[model samples]
Target: MAGIELRKVVKNFGKTQVIEGISQSVPDGTFLVIVGPSGCGKSTVLRLIAGLEEVTSGEIFIGERDVARLEPKDRDVAMVFQNYALYPHMSVRENICYGLKVRGLPKAEQERRLALAADMLGLSEYLDRSPRQLSGGQRQRVAMGRAIVREAAVFLFDEPLSNLDASLRNQMRVELRRLHERLGTTSIYVTHDQVEAMTLAQRIMVMNQGHVEQYGTPDELYLSPATVFTARFIGSPNMNMLRASLERGRLKLPGGTFLPPIPATDAAFTGRAGEILLGVRPEDLLPAGENAPETLRCRVELVEVLGADTLVHCALPNEAEGQEPIIARLEGSSRPGPGDVIHLGIRHGKAHLFDPVTKKRLAV
Candidate 1:
């Protein structure tokens, strides 16, 4: 296993800068995921690390060695592409052992590695089958087995599960995690799926427009997002952002709703008393009891009944024209239909504050 580090890495195509000076470290044996939307340069970053693309500037280190200019073979890394790059003419055994043969390993050693990889991946029974005879998941396992036989120091996966169906993808995700635990190889997975990033990564680096937006553990990014972009991106159902004002330690929302006053000792509100952005997660907004203080009176516009839970989409009374309804995730038992008037309250200390101008979290 090897730790990987990038120091101000930059990549550009012609005059278009795709990677904007990204720098981060992946600890040895760590599962690090780079997640972002399309055109965010996530794949480019992975390719750069694989030595498929040269860096425009900066340095890359693997196991304390500078490999910025090294070829892919010399980088001591194994890559699993999205499409399983298996040879159609070869059986599973031949495909898995082909790399060893190219490197001129003894036949017995090649067999040993192939047996180990096949057993680890549960592909031992299909050794004689060609790629056409295997299911998508099994074929992917074959590709992974090919990489595993190399015993490379680092593993790079570029959206390796995107091609599978939903159920199969989930199954592969568990398999991948288990494989990592067994091999303890430093792995870098690139994907545009936030769900995959949250479940698989020890650390997640969120990128936007070719720049690093946030880098931290899943809990940190979910519970304490440092920027508005991250707050909106990392969560399912997306965080509901509202334009609001803060004055004299109190928060004022649209339609004249007022939240409880902020204590003077709270560092996040210290010296802040103007227009700000309020972020409330769907799960953090709940139905208020009768006569509850600090609640917003809204008219339900739609309701989605998900198993074990309900999503109430509501519009604030007297809200600005064309404003999107805020959704509250509630227990399935609480059924509120369209056109029903209800009051919702933010959970205690669950609200997130952001500077409207800078789009950054507000705190000391």
Candidate 2:
């Protein structure tokens, strides 16, 4: 197992800065996932670690050694790409053992490593099959097996499951977690999918517009996002943000409804009034009665029913023209339908307040 570190890492394409002043550490044997929307430079970060892309400035380190100038082969890290770049003509065994052979390992040693990898990945039953003969998930396992036999110091995965079907992706997620646990290798994973990031990583690094937005455990990013960008990006169905004001320790929403005072702390935005936002997770808000003092009456814009939960899209009265609507997840069954007038209550204490100017969470 190895710990990887990137210090002030920067990458550029011509005049465009793709990765900007990024720094983070991966603890030994820890699985670190870099996640963001497309074009957010998440894949660029993985490629930089894998030595596939040259850094414009800054350093990449493997364990205690600075490898900024090292070649991909010399970095002692294996990368599994989004596409399982398997050679169709090569047998599964050949694909897994190719690197070991090129490295001039003894016949017995290569065979041992190949055998162990195939067995672990349940590929022992298909050793002689070519890439064309295997399923997507099987091909992915071969790609993983190729990396496994390397016994590299670090592993870099670049959306390795993007090509699989939903069910296969889920299956591979479980398999990947088990493999990481068994090998205990330091791994850096990059993906745009938040589900993969939340399920696989010890900590998640959220990126946007070539900058690191927030770095934290999944729960930290979900429960206490560092910025508005993160609060809206990390959650499934997304969190709802409503414009509000703070006046004399009370929340003042649109239409002049005053809510109870939020907890006061240095983290809270004390004096901030206009240009403030109240953020609530979809799972936090609930339907309320008309007499509910803290409730905000919204017209149900849409409803999406999943097996265990239902999402209700709501529009606040006086919402800015052309502004994106808000969404709330109702636990279990939701009796409300489209065009229904519903009262949605802000989850007290659990809700977050942020400064619209700085986009920082108010400590309350």
Clashing pairs in 1: none
Cα displacement (angstroms), candidate 2, residue 54, comes to: 1.0
**lDDT (CA) for every model shown?**
0.91, 0.87
Error of 1 at 139 (Å): 1.0
Tens digit per residue, CA lDDT, model 1, 1-364: 7999999999999999999998898899999999999999999999999999999999999998989999998999998999988999999999999888888999999999999999999999999999999999999999999999999999999999999999999999999999999999999999999999999999999999999999999999999899999999998888989888887678888677789865532666756688888899999998998599889778899999998999989987545764557989999999988999888998887888899999998762
The superposed Cα distance between candidate 1 and the true structure at residue 299, in angstroms, equals 1.4
The lDDT, on a scale of 0 to 1, for candidate 1 is: 0.91
Candidate 2 per-residue C-alpha lDDT over 1-364 given as tens digits, one digit per residue, 9 for 90 to 100: 6798889999999999999888888889989899999999999988888888899999998999888878899999998988988977899999998988889999999989988999999999999989899999999999999999999999989999999999999999999999999999999899999999999998899999999999999999988898999998998887888887777667787657776666654234455556578888888887888888877777888888886898888877754453346788887667578999888886767788788889988774
Every model's TM-score? 0.96, 0.96
TM value for model 1: 0.96
**What is the number of backbone collisions in each predicted candidate, taken in the order shown?**
0, 5
Model 2 weakest 10-residue run by lDDT = 264-273
